[model samples]
Target: MLLALILALGGTMFLQKAFTPKLGLDLAGGTTVTLSPVTQTGQSPPEEILDRAVNIIRDRVNGTGISDAEVAKSGDNIIISIPGVGQSEAIKLVATTAELRFRQVLAMEATQVPQNLSTEAPTPGASPSAQPSSTAKPSSTARPSGRQSATTPSASPTGKALSSALTAPTPGATPEATQTGTGRDQTGQKQNNKGKNGTPTPAPSTPPTAPPNQDPNAGINTQGIDPAVLQQFQKLDCADPKNRGQGVQDDPNKQYAACESDGSAKYVLDVAKVVGTDIDTASAGVRQGTVEWIVQLDFKSKGAGEWSKLTTTAYNAQEPRNKVAVVLDGVVITAPNIISPIPGGRAEITGGFDQVTSTQLADQLKYGALPLKFQRSSIDTVSSTLGSDQLEGGLIAGIIGLGLVVLYSLLYYRGLGLVAVLSLVVASILTYTAVVVLGHNAGFRLSLPHIIGLVVSIGITADSFIVYFERIRDEMKEGRRTLRAAVEVAWVRARRTILIADAVMFIAAIVLYFLAVGGVAGFAFAMGLTTLIDIVVVFLFTKPFIALLARLKFFAKGHPLSGLDAERMSTEPARTTTPQEA
Candidate 1:
């Protein structure tokens, strides 16, 4: 028992930074984001696509080093809960489609679009080519919008209405895709207006300025992109996520409108020259002599030829077209000038990226892109203070339950009750140590259900002691053995019963853990762990302590209060009766 306690406590103390178990979302505070699929062409994507998207999202969340984060699907929506994360950071981290592409910059134009422009679907018969006049002079000043930049035009009801109709919803997008939020923090509150119906509502603040790596004068193919396409580019805003209007998931063989994530500028990008699937592997590292973090990309054999071809084209092209844009989900991540053809099948993206952002990018690149886009359905956040309250309540409930068990044992079993109480303490120590160690090393957080599981285990441990005590009393009542002998015989029977009972419990827990979803699985896991601990404590501590106590005079003599009085347990009373019998 001493060795067990030492190993459990020592291992936990060594592995865990803190002595406490990690808490789940409800008890530790965090952010949750829900994403629903957006089909490309009015038909639902294949099951494989949705499954692959889930895997990609998992990789993306894991890239942030959030081991306790939970990602699961409910019906059609994918839910992501990240403990100890903020709303803005969580959204920025997991909300991206990460559909990376290497596209040429065809044209750059600045035109302002109204914030309240309705993003409604166009009439079925409307001409596909109908667009705003290309003759309109370009504005020099463009403000950041969402994750893109477009010149904000003077407010005109006519212009707003026209822009609304022209920039229709994607063919298969939800009629009114909307994102709601449980704003427990400033970041969450700010992101509450992300989506309304199918429209991209304006954010209260302008997007951040682009990093220093972005070149303002990167050459664009002014002669290549049609004026109408350029006009559309002028209306685009990267700041408003919803502004990625109809057909934004462009065909690989066609020109497209896109923006920089920081809303620094907008671009008319040529067809994709290279895609994410071409990447064989990606990793983030600091440059040899600099503190700047970079993402190194390695391509597969076929991708090598493609990469060589793309680089050669960029190297030979005019100014902006010579700069290949690394675009993700129609937003330009970076556009670096091609100085020479890179045929080595490897390249590095150097930006003013910190370790966190670089690592996130590398993970996105390493995992293949999602086949379908997702609209942010909702975001929820829990404050740490609230989580603390929940944790406190759970702890109080558990303490009360434990106290009741201890009280019952002491009141009923007399001296042996001390043994039961001590056994419980030992079990609790082992359980706590196990939880903490598992939480630290295996990313197992103690959620509310898991806490309940632990509390319920009090009964399980107490039950084992009760079984052994009763069996020992039964043996002594037969009057064929001393207390020591009774204990030995009782243990043989009790051990089998204990094993059978614990086996049933462990099997049930195992089944639930594999079949159940979400928090229930955590509960199942905790239950199984404690059940196993119960068996260990009984064998290592409870039975051994009982045997030792039986050897003591107080217990072996069957003192009335020892809870093991052999005479009191015997069915036959003492032969000598009182005066009434005489």
Candidate 2:
């Protein structure tokens, strides 16, 4: 069964076309990015801020399911190394400041390039009479069939009527850009001008200005909004990437015009009611009684009161005004409508979220906002040749170590050495297959430290064989039982010792793996894996094979070359009772 299982796993690897284990940055070479801190004041950022950024960036990378990525703090800069070339998405994820804010949705419009603005420039002093081509009305009560309700508060239940408004597909919408967690209009075709990271890069040009008399919020209530903000909203073309506001640090005291993360719609959002710092904690989970993924938020004491007030105001407002926008990185990720007053400090943001995206959003929110902003200082591609040289050195060292262990086993055990050698061969095959399969499925990668761990396992495996063989020899020297009987007795005693030793090593590996990071963790993981493999081989193959060999004529009769000769072992003389003594 074990052989068949190995064969099946091998077949799966072949089918998946994963011949080699994924290598780490030190073994395969990857991209290294340096991010320099950009503080509000031109002074250098403090050490704690840099350390905080490092931890957050590392969490973001791991949350994306990319293994073997390293994030470290240098002098006033953060360095990230990912185990693949052209990791643009990873680069963007780490570089983004992930500043989250909750603002009321003042007005919304479908993202479109105005035909007049595209064809001809607007006349200089004439009143700009062109209104938005299409206005998107808020539909917070629109629920998709067969899905759970969008938001449900612990204090007050809103029922199914309140759905995720942003997830509802807007008619006549075009997909031009990519957002982290926002829903897309599947009915529209994707645009071709998107950059490699799925962010649209439109042609660079000045945004057309509106006349002084124009009111962008013409029919809406613009009570608390500034006139200047309204003018900017009137001229803002969300379809243009430059106007989408990628890295702008929006002030919480001001109103702003922002594009949806997916660029499906544009919105004029009110002043921030709750900021990212207000969040006490955030997490992602599946909704009870349903499989829909959602992001749950818990606000701080003061923030909770502010959130309640914001939800109450939105619930009492008109169509579009009833929705609240969740803005991150100066872009609206989702704008769900307020169905009822959500008094509790806790809330959930549900939409077309999958497991990966939900976790990513949760991580960004949980880590809180960075104390300082960052700009990409340099992106350098590491050469694979360097990795190759390091890998070659590690492999050579492992080979030398393995060769010595095998040589010692053969010389000391004589004919019994063949069994030890075969056991080693089986253990190697099992380890290699496991590493390859795990690399393909779990994103595990082999690094220099992992190589060292594998090499050390050679001695561990050989020690198991030596213990059992010595126990058998000791039993045979007593001249009480035959070779087969001695084999069974020796195994009973040896296994106890073997288990204890392996248990100790495994425990140490587990502790080390959890406490360490980067290459040290890799080493611990590899050691633990091989240690388990060693136990499997001993119980399933080594012990059983020795039992079968004991039944052979050469071994049963204690042949000299078999390393089980009676003369070789100091056997006690047979007891003969004298006639008088009897």
Candidate 3:
């Protein structure tokens, strides 16, 4: 037992650098971010929706592998506290809505644009050379009859433009494509234009406000994409950090405007043709035979049908329309062009994703999205000094309790008190070593409540020692046998009581640990741990040491200070004889 104790201590110290107790936010001083749900109608969301949002947020935070994060809901706000995290990380984890939506790309533009192209603004009469005339007539050859057949391959002019734009790879294009799904148009125009002065010109206005004739309900209607939304997409400056914040959710059935997460591009996206629920699973891995990481998506039965129809429409649409936007939390995570009518509802997002980013995205898709959008209402950093003061106070209280237990044993148990004190020292050493090792490997934190639990355990350990000693002295006082025999016999009887007592505490601790949350759970965990350690010390150290001491003249001969003076005890005849016979 001594050897085991020594090995544990040595191992913990040796691995101290790699494994250390993680402190809670209250102790470590980390970042706290509060998020309030943003409802478009200016009223709080339904309680069920809010509850689901909290759960989704919890899953996302857990997926980040941050063990010390606490996600809770207070009133209508969700509060997230992460220990050992910076403000930026805390905000990133909680603020992201992760509401995955699949929308068609109505238009794409360079985020840096000149002048607010607010559709609400009157037409500007600038130089004919500088301002591309918005009213330029559609060429005769490109414009198709309004009654063009929907079934024929090239029936709809827009469909011909889209199929030609999205399916064929652009000349000189590299294998690595940005997630913003754009390729080339039939007109041989680059989907992305590097505009002058960082402000590029707007995308061609919504195609003549006409729904594609191929599938009258191809559901690919441009008529609903408000010109104002298009203007907002045109004016969007991806470089501005302020523009990156979560915004109001657009009607899922209407065209919406959003910017790419990296601020690389801005886009006008068609309403939701697919959403997170339609997705069955998503995984991230290195592309087969390549080093690049990509996220692969698989859709459910209904989602698959929608995905196929959406891809088919996108494949047959014009430049920006051929692209599909992957929006998360009202922000464009990526937009990829439909290279083909993707069948089977399986697709790959092959942006310039690294393993870490791809894995993160995959996690978000697989875990499902939050039901409500959240905006960061407040963020603050907590200092460790307050935690340090509380810890210091707890330690002082624990030491005082321990000291009292030891002092009482000395005064009452006499020479037996020495045994009790030594046993306690051993238990303490064992408990400390176990906690440090567990903290390092299991992410256990030593909170104030846990400290109190440990203090309580000191008294419990002393009680076991007292029980065994008193039993042995009682046997000797009855003149039944020698000290060694008394020690041996008393242990047999005392162990049963000790086991039952410890068992009750152990069971209670287990129940409390599982049923409680927060700090109370921490206390229960400590209690359970120490209870087991007390058992180990009693069997391996306490019993053996007491048996060994029973052979010493100091105790066997019943010295006054030995706490078992046979002369001072009752010298009654053996219990087999009655008092009248004696």
Candidate 4:
């Protein structure tokens, strides 16, 4: 029965290990970021302060494109579990206080701005920092733009004629003269006046000279500015048509307009009146090598006509500027200089990008606005190397703990201790196999705490054996003639107490696991697993082993090592038993 029970438990554990998924910190790495309110007089912060802080922290985490992150309050402290956000950005995001503010760019030029520079700008709102330590490392500077140096990536390839962009070209000239020597015709043939291709019909090759005529629309007129540059920004407007103040006789607050240069010279853009929230849907995906994403922006009825007008103006421009900047969290992600006006308004951003970053951008834009700003309180990175060292230490401790338990139990309990030793061996096999299987199945990770729990449980296993042994001694004192009857009676009482003890532990563990945050959950889970293993060992291995021993002559006759004497069982004290008993 003992062997059968062991085999069954072992097999079941092995199967579970094979099929179950083990939990991982990264896969479900639940971390608690604790935010304590700044305490006056250096005591604990007040309840009201903590509550407000937690609310804001929760808001920031939810906005971060991380799924399943949670925040809750505990006695003057806020605990946040940034779950399912893997080890990388999880550390970066949580540690960031996200203390956003509209600090005016003050001066980008070597010259100072005039003090009266009031184009009434920007906005801000805040609750407080969401952590105990109010300190945060200063944010790193943004990567430098390449435009400051010629070596920097040339301002996103304009693809416009170089001459027009270098110095504005004329408003009038023959189409042939206006185009570059490398440009194409309606039939897609290269139109080179230099006779690089096509039939060189024959040129009398007149010498280049100053124009005799000052006609504004005349041939090869190289004058004041470029017509192509004028066409590029002719109708740019920042305010969406639908989003002007209540009734628009034109909002005096609209701050942006089409400029001679691309937005490079502009630092501030108009506040979005009709934000991304008005749009119904947006999604991002990767096709081939490019990151392709689309936004389906439908305007509020009031905004639609205005948006159409904005597009029409851009559409009717000399060169036609059709694209608007795709902005998010106050940063421009991409600006595709459209070749034609998009009255439809909805647009696509196509560039080389992997699937993940594209999806994250779309999610942020779709969410519109965040309710609260988060201040990252603390961030910690746990390395796999440390995890491995911890695992090794735990294993060594478990083995040592088990060896000590075995050495002492054998020296003290004699034959009774053997039962405990066997039960533990079986339990160890089951636990080890289950842990491995669970690693694969549930993504389970056995931290050092779990190993310690297993080692401590060795004492719990021994206690059960001691309880049964003591119960059997009581039965012997009550004058039981048969070993089997005494064994059976003792088991009934011992099983009850054993079960009750395990049940209480299991219940406590369950409650703690669900309620406690972070590392405490690991503690609770290990306790619960061990409590379960304890019960299995008792019901299947212990009881069956004791039952099988009852029928053995050595045990029935009361062997000395077994600490059993028939005389002890029989109250008359005649001592009818084996010589070992004497």
Name the top TM-score candidate.
Answer: 2
Q: Per-residue lDDT for 1-582 in model 2, tens only?
A: 668867977997999998898888887888999999998788898888788888888777754232678888888888999887888877877888778888997776655443333222111211111221133332322222222223432221432212222232221133222223222222222224556776554432332344678864545566666878877876777767776555667888889888865455677889999999999988887655456677888889998899889988877777567778888888876676565666657777765577877876787788767667889999998865448778888889888988888788777777788889899999999999988988887778788888988889889888899999999988877745677778889999999999999999999999998778887888888899999999999999999999988777767777677777766676553222222332
lDDT of 1 by residue, 1-582 (tens): 567675867676776566878777777778889998887577767778788888777766644222446788787788988776564755665766666787876654333333543223222222222333353211111123221111111123332111111121111111121223211111112223235564444432333344679853333335677666666775666557565432145567777878654444467887887888888998887544245466777878888788788877865665445556777766666565454556757666644467777877887778767677788898877555447677788889999998998888878888899999999988888888878777766567777888889998889888999999999888777645667777899999999999999999999999997776567777888899999999989999999999888767777776778876645577553222222322
The list of candidate 3 runs beyond 4 A from truth reads 18-28, 40-42, 52-74, 83-91, 96-369, 383-389, 475-479, 551-553, 567-569, 572-582
Worst 10 residues of 2 by lDDT: 120-129
Question: Judged by lDDT against the true structure, how good is candidate 3?
Answer: 0.64
Write the residue-wise lDDT of candidate 3 on 290-333 in tens digits.
45466777889999899889988976776657667777767765
The TM-score values for the models, in the order shown, are 0.51, 0.70, 0.54, 0.41
Better of 2 and 4 by lDDT: 2
Better by TM-score, candidate 3 or 2: 2
Model 4: per-residue Cα lDDT over 26-126, one tens digit each: 34355556655443366765566556555545444544211335577767556666543354454434333321111111111011122332211111111
How many backbone clashes does every candidate have? 20, 0, 11, 26
How do all the candidates rank in terms of lDDT, highest first? 2, 1, 3, 4
Q: How much is the lDDT of residue 295 in candidate 3? A: 71
